[model samples]
Target: MSLSAFLSARYGRGFRDRAQIEAHHARAFALFRQRVMPRSPFYRDLAQVPLAALPRMSKARLMENFSAINTCGIRYDQALDVALRAEESRDFSPMIGKVAVGLSTGTSGQRGLFLSTPRERALWAAIMLGRFWPSLARRQRVAFFMRADNALYRRLSNPLVRFQFFDMLTPWQDHLSRLEALDPTVVIAPARILGQLALAGPRIAPQRLISVAETLLPEDRAAITAAFGVPVDEVYQATEGVLAMTCRAGSLHLNEGWLRVERDVIDPATGAFCPIIHDFTRESLPILNYRLDDVLVPDPAPCPCGCASLRIARIEGREDDMLWWPGRAGLRLVPADAIRTMIACLPLRLRDWRAIQRGNVLEIWLDGAEGDAERPLRDALADLGRRLDCTPPELRLHAGLPPEPDAKRRRVRVLPA
Candidate 1:
């Protein structure tokens, strides 16, 4: 794909007319379907099939049928072996021939492996520069933090774009001096790690801040923004593909020009959707109607920036995090956003918090910078019970931080059935 042509098609022209944007995406989708459908044996039956009629794909299904589903013809066992070995060795330079292989964090039980060829890597870099970087002409420094390193990101380094990869697994203090010395123009990291960085209050504030991997909480955003003197922008990407990104107005919008997003609506009243992605740019590992379990809230009104892409107000927690309880009628799943909002409204300040639903008991963990969070915690539970219209589950307050910074911090989680 030509970098100039791609950027000009989307950003330069500013496809502000909704119908025009839709027309552009429809053409791209048609081209993608024509090229990709015939190559894979798995999708042979899906040739000329309607997108909705094509069978839905999940992580488990993807992993189980990697060899067949992937057009690149990489074996599942071979890919898993290399990915696992790299994770253990902490050396991510290895690849499946020209394709870069990386493993998911496995916050869910089943871990996943993703592949990207050199061509795909270059395309990703070009698209990222167009979307996130302030300008193509100016030189910029970037510090990217993540658990696993990919060759796709390393390819971003150039004279114009000086990119540094910080390993999240390493001790945060080890890189403090480097961060100070680099004094990056833009900082990208997980929301949890960004909050930890905010506490340090580094002298060199970044002009742009981007949060990825985890859900960017309001409190976390406030803390980071206060420390850096810049509003936090979010990139809602997954192992699946680069999905949505924050606009100039700081509103998160799906990259509809490159990817088609279908709303698998779970809650009609709240307008919450589980995103089903169809990425035209992904040729090696074609992602079509690949559904994600995470819940996202869609904004009905147009954004102030007037970008015609699909607008997402906020990303709620994952589907597994949504607490389900047996109500008078049937099993009811508590809205993750409601649970978070209720906790955030508490009278006392919470340094960090988490609620885990194990069977009928709701175990609460609250870390307060101040003294005695017990009273406030109890009050929050009382309010939560009233909102859900169910008997309060046995509330267990753990001694330590709600979710220790060392691990994946989930606001809501339900034990496996």
Candidate 2:
């Protein structure tokens, strides 16, 4: 493992200001240009170009040119074959030589393929182990829950750390017994599954509970904390990499050390923006000037934990989850947070709810409601529309919640127009 990176992450100096952050980015990008970009056939010729001048990347575009974009020269078709085969066989281990191949789906169900090398995996292990290993003095058991296991995580298995992967493809109820058997010190899973585990009241008392893969709503966090009696921590990650993590102050801090983040602000009032990332540490697949679909609201105040890194108020879900309504200026953005808050503030205690915009209608589903919710909810939407200076989509109410998918939970969604 990368002991130096581990030690540095745990006990190294942090940027106190923007100037220092820029300086670090300069040095990191320089190294990436000299060492990593030259290996990628797609980027080798453009190594000297400014990062912003380079072409942008997305999951679809990356998949289309995967053969040329990757430094390792692995063909997209071959990698897809291996990944599909592994999924079919229910095998979590799939690799190409020393590289691990992983398949991920976007919020809109778009397919994505990623590769991680041995050194990269080691560096990842170092950072995670250093930051959240619980205690070095005693052996720690870690239970990781995900749809598939990548070697990047499996590398953490050793004498001091008993790492187990709980495949989400199987029935989670069945895994509860196994989870109790381990009684892990650290539990990691999507926010929904974590909530499920909490409701099950697993006898295992974990020291740390990490929510990943899905958006962690305030309700989910409350449920988890009430069950575990510990503050719920979050890891805001995508297939791209570990974009952000919770600091000691319990705020989400951008991982400014590994990459440079440029904002594409959509709302100046809230300072809500889509992040454009330039990752220097990823050598296997060059991610330069890449735009992600996730929205983030920046926290201007410095973190009390002494981390000078950029802090975020919340992850506003994906662009697809945002509701758009008719406005004088055109379509106005109705963020997922607004919809969630509206539902939360209502007098009715809803066990579950979802808001989906389709065509000219906004479909709302409510669970465990005692009285008429349609009128109050419709009024709330009208009020929200008035605030935004837009017309809310037509409201359609349903009695029960939507069917649960086998993937991440989405409480708000805006279907394609």
Candidate 3:
């Protein structure tokens, strides 16, 4: 079944244009309405309504209406209980009957309960393994680093695959020996963790390194690639589902075959938009017109892979984290990439850097920065502000790096004072 799901996802959709993708969505949604929507008490009545007419769903809204939304008749409170219990015990084996219940990491304001049936889990594992599998002849060892384990991911373990889960709560330094001992052929972790592992110089030379959960920055990719002698690949997945993955050409492409993506543009200049997704592949929970807070910058240039799916240039941080500087006409967004470029051009060789905006203040932290490095950075930012027709945030320069977060590592952030 896993192999069949893999073959279908990898080769079934020979989508070559926008029309083909839309036609696919039409057929998928038709089947979904006929087979899946009637099962869901919440969506049963709204089955006939146009997709655009459906209410936009957020994490909070979904959790609030969880009992009615799911086809499995799982109550919100009951599901949360199961999810929380597994989180506390660190044993993800428990499930609400045949459905796997897991809690989202809650980066998007509220924690969410995600459900997957046996089939859903199989399809997920198949797509991942089929697309990113290094080789089929050899039994591959996979070291998966995650904040919490879910039975959904456990499906990847079979006779041909050795799957090892590393709990993120454990000290990373302590895992080094076990990691070296395992000698995994594929190492998967959050981007920052992968970057640190690259620097740690572990003996394991993985053929493939996949970055998940967190945004992969330019520096992180460069370091990981240099150390491992393999280009860093990415899997942009959320509790929502697998949204996108890196193609063989090393470009990030949306999984348009499994879902329909609608863009809500936030930064027109950069073509940066928050994605509104309708995933027909999810039967346990129907995710229609689900608006994610993540900002994605689209690449207009065509990918060499010729898949014709939308290629993503980068995943900008959350909408809340987008830096908005005061301008004469209105608030102007300061792209995180711009800040990185400004710092990169600086005379000082920075070991590390972080930019944080709070109200009218921008705090800049630099490792290996001396007092002399401040003036040049300040000048560069001022120049940028002028170019953007905005007032530069009051600069607060610090000489040392900020303490890294235990969860996802965001190099740049914006928040209230």
Candidate 4:
């Protein structure tokens, strides 16, 4: 579908002009307010304030009122039951058309259930296709990587487009074999996984590469782009949903039609956001002004891509992921991304490293390197301390790094005494 036609259908033709986007927002917001206030008893009660007077909603508040927020005819308990059954049966789309329900594979402690309407799904697909492959012809194959096989992949099919799913949990050799067989034009996967694939060097080739799920670390980005011989498009998607995607110029662009994001900049010391979200596409569950637990920094400049949609720099890990360090005043929480950046900056030989915090002491575990590595790693850790305004505590180096049981690896671990 043409962008103009899509915009007209969603926000009316008047909104096609850049000047009328706000009017479109206003109209959409009004409809959202009306729908949620009456239909969603959960939101109505939690959002005691009138729709006009309601401030941005928070994650905590949404969880607290989880039962009352769903506008879909299904009850919360019923939906949960349906979701669990669907998940077990491998029929993930059981509740899709009636009420778009999808399970969040929560790497973070809390697993969430997200819902949307078929209309929202269609809009999401259209915006995604328009933004990501504006110039591509109808016939193209896209290879997607995720931990589990999903029924949602079927929703992306069209007569001209084909999508192949690659399971990340499967062995790397298996993926390589599948990729050789598929020969997809486009490839999408997490940055770390793609970096691992890049280590093989050049057997896999695609016209375009897209990174999603995790923050694309600079070193990994450089390596993958070099290996693939194509600029890597980083997509800012999370369990919450497909938040945003990068344009041709590599600027992260918000999916304005699917959702609206309000960023909360938290002081690392206090692991909480000020809280704010104005989700317009949430009908099954009213996500009005929810506070996301994740930390993010809003982009300071408008994207050169010409879309007015607001964008954010990579999500710098969740609040709980921050490592605690001993400080003169008290214990201070340091963002894990800071440590990751420090490690990335170091010129040390290492396969993988994990930072573990126990009370006042910090432990650094190294996987592929040994004894002589202390100097550079220590210097990097010391530099991180300086940047975070905390003293460099004793760093204990482990001979080997241990893996976490979960499929999702924890780069930083906080251990209890």
Per-prediction TM-score to the true structure, in the order listed: 0.92, 0.96, 0.96, 0.83
Tens digits of lDDT, candidate 2, 1-417: 399888877776567888898999999999899999999999999999999999998878888888999999899998898888878897858689999998887676889988899999998889888777788898999999999888988988888999999989888688989999999999989998899899899899998888989989988899899999988788888888889988767898899988888998987778989999998888998888889989898999988887788999989988666677789998888878889889987778778898878889899999888788888998898999999999988889998888754377889877765
User: Number of clashing pairs, model 3?
Assistant: 0
The number of clashing residue pairs in each candidate reads: 0, 0, 0, 5
How far is 144's C-alpha from truth in model 2 (Å)?
0.7
lDDT tens digits by residue: candidate 1, 292-365: 99888899888888787878888877776766666575555567776788778777677677778887788877
Position 289, candidate 4: lDDT:
58
lDDT against the true structure, each candidate: 0.80, 0.87, 0.88, 0.65
Whichever of 1 and 3 has more TM-score, that candidate is 3
Candidate 3, which segments miss by more than 4 Å at Cα?
8-14, 403-406
lDDT of 4 by residue, 213-288 (tens): 7777666778888888888887776545666767555777666655655556566433334335566765667666
**Residue 189 displacement (Å), model 3:** 0.6
Better of 1 and 4 by TM-score: 1
Provide the lDDT at 163 for model 4: 81
Q: How many Å off is the CA of 163 in candidate 1?
A: 1.4
Q: Is candidate 3 or candidate 4 better by TM-score?
A: 3
RMSD of each: 2.5, 1.6, 1.6, 4.3
